[model samples]
Target: MFLAWNEMRRNKIKFGLIIGVLIMISYLLFLLSGLANGLMNMNREAIDIWKADAIVLNKDANQTVAQSSVNTDDINGKFDKSEGLKQTAVIATDGKLKENATVFGIDAKGFLMPKLEDGKLFKKNNEVVADHTLKTKGFKIGDELSLSNSDEKLKIVGFSESSKFNASPVLFTNDETISKLNPMFKGDKINALVVKDKNWKDAQLNKDLEVIEIEDFVTKLPGYQAQNLTLTFMIVFLFAISAMVIGIFLYIITLQKRNLFGVLKAQGLTNGFLAKSVMSQTIIIALIGTLIGFGLTVLTGAFLPEAVPIKFDYLTMSIYGIVLILVAILGSLFSVLSIRKVEPLKVIG
Candidate 1:
């Protein structure tokens, strides 16, 4: 430890460069982690809030809620308690004002209808509760919304937070509203069923429909799995690059001090002791630099606009910090092994 600290103090610029590289890497990782989480939240917020164990959809729908359409008669006795949902996208026009929204037609008293963050729940078919994000787009309570597709106009009665669907603002309405807006959606048909029962038997549901767990259902959202995997791969590659950077830097430093290590070995210093110095230096550089990068990331996130959605999950960031430290320690092993190869007699001779 003494040797490591003394050398670091003596070679501040050299060590500082490695720390700088690590700091940049840590910053990117934290930012990416927050971004990945935010995108996921934006994609699955409504589903998570539903808190359902599973949902029922058509077999051919491939677990996609928007693609599945279930008839009321098909699931009559299948679930003891369940709410059917119908969905369609509509352009809400208020004079020159225009807003695109995905509408969910749900039972007024069902568990799927979330408690309003602002106003009262919709009591009539023509009234709707909308995602709070719409408020920022200039929508408010008691404002009438005209659907371009159907003659039936609607009104916003309430707003709910985290009510997004597939990254689009959502409007919660009823079957009667969907029936009017979507010509194909008959009063007897629904897109999917949010089943509340966890003990459903295979034979209980219709032969054409299949059950999907909530987790799997979210992944089926359009472009969700592909986008998530792409971001995940990017983050994983960054970590691998971080480990490689530490290894290469230590290897180069070890090469430069080969003769010094040999001289120390000639004075009876063991390879383990030399290795300990290298490991200590790696840990110090990793831990200190990673924390600094995290601090910078938090500061950056504060100044970012709401349009740039970033959700900092402190627990995951903490885990990644430990991971970076461990990676650096692992990387130092190459230098540790190189130190053991140094010949005490070679340098002195």
Candidate 2:
């Protein structure tokens, strides 16, 4: 510990550079994880709220509820403990700013109907409850939203929590409003069904329909898997790069301090003591850099717009921090091994 601190104190700028690099890497990783998690939440927040066991969608819909279509036979199938759903995406406008939003047609009394955070659920055919984000966009109770592609209009009766789908705002309405909003999906039909039994794995019930776990349903949402895969690869590669950067930097320093290690060994310092210093140096550097990086991440998140999808999971961040420290310690193995191999006689000779 003394040798590690003495060298770090003597070469403050070199070690500072290492810490800076680590800080940037850790910051990027944390930021990326938050964004990925937030986006995932937005894409499937409604499903999370439903707390449903699984989803039943048309096989042809590619597992996306918005693209699914359930016929009368499918809806009336001898299924038990399920509620039908009619879902679609439409452009909403108030004769001014237009934006895309998702409309969910669910039974007002079904288990899928979330408890209102404010106001009441839809009591009439066209009365609807919207996500609070819509309220931010000038929508409020008693305000009418015009469906651009259809003659149907929605009366906002209430507001729900942060329920979103396909990275867009959500509106909850009855099946009547849904059918009118999109005539093609009209009739006694539904886009999908929500099952209450978590063990509902009746995939082969009908060749045209399939039941899937909630996680699988979320994973198959449009662009959800793609975004996750891309960000995961980037994070993994960044971890590897961090290890390489630390390992190479320490290796170069080890090369420069070969004679110093030999002289210390001659002065009666055991190689084991010198190796402990190297490990201690790695731990200190890793902890300092990661903490600073996390602080910066939180600071930046505070300034970001509300629309930015970022959710901080402190537990996940802590686990990442531990992994980073372990990786850094592993990186310093090259230095530790080099120090252990130092022969005092060779340097003195």
Candidate 3:
């Protein structure tokens, strides 16, 4: 460790340059991760806010909430505790200010509805609560908003945080209002049911119904799985590339110090000491670079535009940091090997 520190102090510029490169790479990885998480939340934040243990969808719907069809009869006595049915509909607003929005039909008094950030939940069929994203589009409490296909005008009564789905702001309304908007969803029929029972998997239901955990249901969202998989693959490959970069750089550094190492060994120093120094140096560099990257990620997220979705989860960031340090240590393995191979006698001669 002392030798490694001495070498770094002696060649500050070279090590600084390597650290700079690592910082850039690590920052990019963290930024991409935040963006990926943000996009995913945009697609499922509405459901995520529900905090339901599981969702019951019609088997024929292929695990899609939008396609599933259920009613009061299907949910009766099916679980230890079941919230009222929830359904979703995509509708365009009448004016140019708002284009497309997802309307969520939830029972007004049910547990699935999110708490309001502003105003209270809807008290009448004509009143509605909406995601705070709608505020950016010139909407406010008491403003009457009309759907593109329907004659009914809904009054915005409240707004909630993180209540978006399918990359659009969500509007909350009762089943009765939804039925008025689209006659197809008649009395007691809904898209799916949110259940809170541990034994849901063992419960026997109609052959046409299927129960799935909320996590699985989120992946089933359109394009969500594919997008997340692509981002995750990119992150993995980037980490691998970082490891290779670190390994190659450290290997070159080790090669330059081969004679010094040989001389130390001739003077009775051990290979294990040199290997530990190399690993310690790698860890220090990696940790500094990763922390800088994390700081930049947080700064960027703080200043990002409201329209841009970017979520920075602490747990996710911590995991990424751990993985980066591990990969960096793994990358130093080649340098350790090079140190182990040094020949004291030949170099001394």
Index of the highest-TM-score prediction: 1
Structural similarity to truth (TM-score) of each candidate: 0.94, 0.93, 0.92
Give the least accurate 10-residue stretch of model 1, judged by summed lDDT.
Answer: 197-206
Computed on alpha carbons, the lDDT of every model, listed in order, comes to 0.87, 0.85, 0.83
Clashing pairs in 3: none
Residue 17, candidate 1: alpha-carbon lDDT: 99
Model 3 over residues 274-294: C-alpha lDDT tens digits? Answer: 888899899888988899988
Give the local distance difference test score of model 2.
0.85
Q: Give the candidate number with the greatest lDDT.
A: 1
Which of the predicted structures, 1 or 3, would earn the higher TM-score when compared with the native?
1
**Which sections of candidate 3 miss by over 4 Å?**
86-88, 94-96, 136-138
Candidate 3 or 1, higher lDDT:
1
Q: Comparing 2 and 3 by lDDT, which wins? A: 2
Candidate 2, 1-349: lDDT as tens digits: 7778888999999999999999999999899889888888888888888888888888999888878887757545445578888888888876675779989988888888766877899989989899977877777788788887888888889998888887898889988788888786766678888888745765346688888788888887879999989988988888898899999988888888889889989999998898898888888889999999999999999998877889988888888888998999999999989988889999777
In model 3, the number of clashes is 0
